[model samples]
Target: MDYTATLNSMGQGLCYALVSILFIFLAKKLDDWRTKNFDDDRHIDDGNLAVGLRRAGLYLGIAIGMIGALSGESAGFRTDMLYLLVDGVLITGCLFFSRFINDFVMMGNMNNDRECVKVFILGDGRTVTGNTALGTVEAGMYIATGFILNGSMSGSGGSFVQSLGSALLFFVLGQFVLLGFGLVYEMITPFNLRDEIKQNNPAAGIALAGILIALGIILKASLSGPFTGWVNDIVGFFVYTLFGMILLIGFNALVDRFLLPTTNIATEIKEDKNVAAMVLVQATIIAVALIIAHAI
Candidate 1:
């Protein structure tokens, strides 16, 4: 309706566009340096879909991390730009290095970086390319942590240093829950969780990735908004995650009963490697998580 206002918006959009390009480029160059014993760009050039997905996820993660800084309370165009650039660089540095922590912690004994880029030779004169399972899971880690960081970097209650402390604390807390959830999930599920993922079973990996992403969404809610004392907030986070975990497990149970009463989901996924079934599982998990997140 207002031509002058529209023109100003367009001008600002162009600035954001340029910054976005530069931010992503900077993240890629940082990845090149941070990734150890692995060459993501070379593998991507060699047509590895797994590597491509991981790299894509990293970019998307960077964007998500920037969203809070971009949209939060603005001090003016210049201040907003300052926050955007600062947050972009911070997100890149944190997430790039966090990849190593995730590879070691959440992945257990498996080396995800190596797994994604490793070549395989089969006994029947056939070669398996890359491990899509590890790739997808690693991507999930990036995207999920992005949401977590977004929450940490949000709100107007604390100083920047304090926010950093809260972010680090939340990140560590999220990791412990994730690790515990994996163990609990393994105990309840019929299939060998680690074995399936290690074997490059796409279905298993998808399920695991779905859980992590869903957990991230739910945790983001806990970390959002103003600080209400550290003890209360941390307790609230644990409570929210506890409820979310129950719902995640219960939803899977319901799916087993109502969705696939005759067929065992474990069998379909582990034995048959039914990606469709896993897709259903993944969708259900995220759908439940979304509901829980909004309700919280």
Candidate 2:
């Protein structure tokens, strides 16, 4: 092993650690402002530390991936540092844009305390309200998008302006994919997602969450970076992404038809509020995502 090379790597790792902390702090401040204005619940207020950490963790993950992608073997500390700051800020913006789409376009945060029924009240009036795990699955959606975006931006090799354009285009493309998925989900269901969530329907929330995460998992492969300078490279990227998403949808439909012929997932979720059935759907979605991701 080369001692000098090892030392240099360690130094770069330290810089990454410091920058990650800064990114998380900045994201939290923005999240705080969002909570204050929009009535978005803070994970801390509900004592769900996992949710809080997951949000910050996604930011850190994106920053690290971006830095690694941009910092070539020959790049020095200063060049890498510059890449880190610029990419970090852009990725953070991506995070914010995702939040906007979820809240406004998807109506994710439509109602909190206003329409939510205490879980205990629905049952035997026990003291313990069951964990709805509300907001958790949606948060997973953000994290999955982060992973995809990070991969897409890697090895971009373009000028900063070109990279920025590419990143923005990819972001819009990602949102459209998500939107298309949500619309399909809504069409299949009797009840609207926002209304279901508002009424404290855990089944609806969990299944939707699974769908988003699974789509992200499969899409990550399509976003695998190192894009070339050729115009065909850009065209191929979009084509592959659409192909992956469509294939996943078809695969999911087959699973529903063949794996559980008698079961109606949407009705079970909307009418029965069957958490176990929802879990089964979630599991299938994840299983498919894992298989596809591995194949890719």
- The candidate that achieves the highest TM-score relative to the unseen native structure: 1
Which ten contiguous residues of candidate 1 have the minimum total lDDT?
A: 66-75
Clash count per candidate: 0, 0
Candidate 1 per-residue lDDT over residues 253-278, each given as its tens digit = 88777777778778877888888988
Q: RMSD in angstroms, all models?
A: 2.4, 4.0
The model with the greatest lDDT is 1
| Model 2 steric clash pairs | none
- Mind giving the per-residue lDDT tens digits that candidate 2 earns over 94-159? 877776676566655543222222343455554423234345444655766775676566655667
Off by over 4 Å in 1: 35-39, 121-125
